[model samples]
Target chain A: MFPEELKYSKEHEWVKLEGNVATIGISSYAQEELGDVVFVELPKAGQEYKANDEIGVVESVKTVSTLYCPVSGKVTAINDELSTQSALINQDPYGKGWIAKVEMSNPAEVESLLSAKDYQSQLAG
Target chain B: MLKKTALYKNHIDLKAKMVPFAGWEMPVFYPAGIIAEHKAVRSSCGVFDVGHMGLINIKPQTSNIKKAEEFLNKIGTNDVSKLIDFSCQYSVLCNEQGGVVDDVLIYKLIDHYIVVVNASNTDKVLAWLSSHAQDIEIEHLLDMSILAVQGPRSLDVIEELFGEEFGFNVLKRNNFLQVGNILVSRTGYTGEDGFELFIPLEEIEIIWDKVVEMKVQPCGLGARDTLRMEAAYPLYGHEYDEKTTPLDAGYSWAVKFGKGEFIGSKALSKEKEAGPKKRLVGVVLSEKNVPREGFKLFNGGAEPIGEITSGTFSPTLEKPIGLAYINNSCHEKNISVEVRGRRVAGEIVTLPFYKHS
Candidate 1:
């Protein structure tokens, strides 16, 4: 289930904002949609920002998908711990599985995201 | 995009993740992950909608069964004479040059025989079978549905679902036992002990729902792949096709020339005497990089030798493994895979990368 507090993207990524920083991770729905994520190539720290740009790779047993940015920002942190323990995304897509932390370049860019209800309805359609 | 099966709506109703396979919208998995579904078959029963495969029924003149023997050799199943009606076998239908046309199932169902072939090779096998057997009578050529209920617990599941009267031990290979309307055969693609049921296309949903109610997981192509690979079974298109020979695919046992004549036999005999130039071998990537399809294979000395045909991150082995066609000499020696240009040391193993538990 998606939390109404978070902003979403059509690509199934969720961004939770606190001030100008966004803790970004794939939505629980995304992780569930892509069964058994074997590996995730998260964006590197210090990488520059963009909205709807390919930032990382999320690989399941069957396919490799590109994770896109929903809001423009510069990468400040990534869950380096996921490199060796990739299954963390399946276990905790919301908290410990957060892919990267970005410092937003323009706070107004958050408006580009769809709300939780809209994302769920998008999947239903 | 509108291709649907009898159970298509039911699959969507059960929240099945559908994918396009051979132009058919088929379920690849349900809520459970691939690994979980795979393990279920290893320890319990699981059902698969292999309804996509082609089924052709042929009624050759009883006397022409001898001529059918000739087609066997023509097809690279050297052992045509040894095949009996109650006997089911795996064979590769070949073109004129001894290259595989399709890996097929030769089942003698009743007086007329039946063949179950790959969905992708349906038309090819049909045309090949038609062109060769001009004298033979092909009775009803229908698109029948087939399902595989496989795993160690499959027998029990079958008993529970269809009653013990179906004859657990009596139903031999190539022989079909009718339970109500279902024809249950002791056959499956997964190396696990199970049966492949041939039912009317329309009744697929009814039987599928019953099996699901009996706790048989509706596994998709994803689990089907991992399960078959673990069993060391060959994928028709990937491991062998119009370009690869069965002898090179470790299927020399299926070819029996002792009885009589067949197509591709002469060329296969030549290749057998001379030995296939490239052989299919199993290899496990010893490093982190996944050995994907088309990855070049090299000798331990870093010299290019061959390339991977089918590869995947094995759910059972918890590592990358694959099947590759390599030089016979290099196959005997150890080899490595070049994943994105880096040579990862891999030992040349046998057919299966993982044994069934």
Candidate 2:
């Protein structure tokens, strides 16, 4: 169930660009693969991260997975609700489960991300 | 190639997430997820398709029951002579080095004894039993299927399925009874009043469908592991391996030394007198980070004390809990586990993180 407006990465992350700030969260497929999310460790705001850097950690009942930064930028905000309710990622991966918002440092990185159709094909392949 | 259980098609119909485990393509969880399946068993009722476990029968060549008992007693850590008809006992097979070969449940039937071994160690245990056979016949029941119905409401589910006249409600724990073609045992891995039904391969699907029709949640191995962990049950390859003795695994009560000479008895007796070098202990982490298997343990020092054997987030306790084999020398009050290369503070707690009262 890939949203049409979202850009996706091979690592199963979805990004939504609204001007200079890009909202990022794991895809619905990633949440399904992780099972029930029990805990999440989000990065602090104002911290800068390069593309493909480890941005956060997601822990489910079975295992843990590392979330990667899709675009190099400073973290503007993170969803603080995940500290108490990590299952939001499973319930709403596109909306309320957004992990972080990054103020982009390199806008050209968006072109490298796959569209919703391409990302769905990548998952099938 | 992975082996499929009798309920493989049923699991697929339920939309279960299948994963490879112990050479079988088993369902790890259903669409309800592991946490929900776990909670359902805790509060209501849940069914598990554990047909992957091995069932080996030890029958005497003659009508002499004593010879069969003696043979089993020599190979197992527990006393087999104490088992009465329709009763089962938890025991462990050990190597000569005092390490565990596999933990099993020995069910003594009228004419023969059935030993249920772990799925992964089925072939090894069969060969081990065959090598030690004297006048005993060790037959593997490859076409058997095991269904475990567990929870607080498990008795009700059993009554609903088999009817009240069967008297399953009165069946004592660790005891089994033979129905027409099925053998029902009042035993389970989950810390709950439950029953394990030993059904024929062809009959398992019908029983499973009936159980599901009654609104019983069908659980997978993912929930099974968490349920057993919460109950502090020692699993093979995790707490008890070829190198881990029953003494080190906190299963001393099951090892009866007064039963006379058995496999690994001399070595285990020596270890008992001197005490185990390392002991399995439960640790509760202060943080939410899970301490996985092979993670190093520290006692507030630079040196590592031991390593985790099994770790998971306890859905009931809502905390990260684990079992570790810490060196007995390290008696520090505060311990830490290295999780993802970071130290997380923890404290040693009593076993069975969650007990059903």
Candidate number of the best DockQ: 2
Of candidate 2 chain B, the 10-residue stretch with the lowest lDDT total is B326-335
Highest-TM-score candidate? 2
Over B1-357, each residue of candidate 1 has an lDDT whose tens digit, in order, gives: 546666788889888899888778988888887878887888788899887888877665666566555554455474645566655677778776778888888776446567788887887777787777766765434546888899877888778877887577667655567677677888887778888988888788888898889888878888898788777788887888887888888888877767555677777778999988988878886664556678888765556788887776677778767778888766354677876456778888877776655
Error of 2 at B322 (Å): 0.7
Q: What lDDT does candidate 1 reach at residue B113? A: 61
Q: What are the per-residue Cα lDDT tens digits for candidate 2 across B1-357? A: 999999999999999999998999999999999999999999999999998899999999999988889999999999998899999999999999899999999999988999999999999999999999999999999888899999999999888888889888789999988888899899999988899999999999999999999999999998998899999999998999999999999899999999899999999999999999999899988998888889999987798999999888888998888989999777876899998878999999888888889
> Relative to the unseen true structure, what is the C-alpha lDDT of residue B182 in candidate 1, on a scale of 0 to 100?
71
What is the lDDT for B56 in model 2?
96
Off by over 4 Å in 2: none
> In order, what DockQ does each candidate have?
0.51, 0.85
The alpha-carbon lDDT assigned to residue A102 of candidate 2 equals 99
Clashes by residue pair, model 1: B28-B220, B73-B262, B73-B263, B74-B262, B74-B263, B78-B256, B79-B256
Q: Which 10 consecutive positions of candidate 2 chain A have the poorest summed lDDT?
A: A55-64
TM-score of chain B of each: 0.92, 0.99
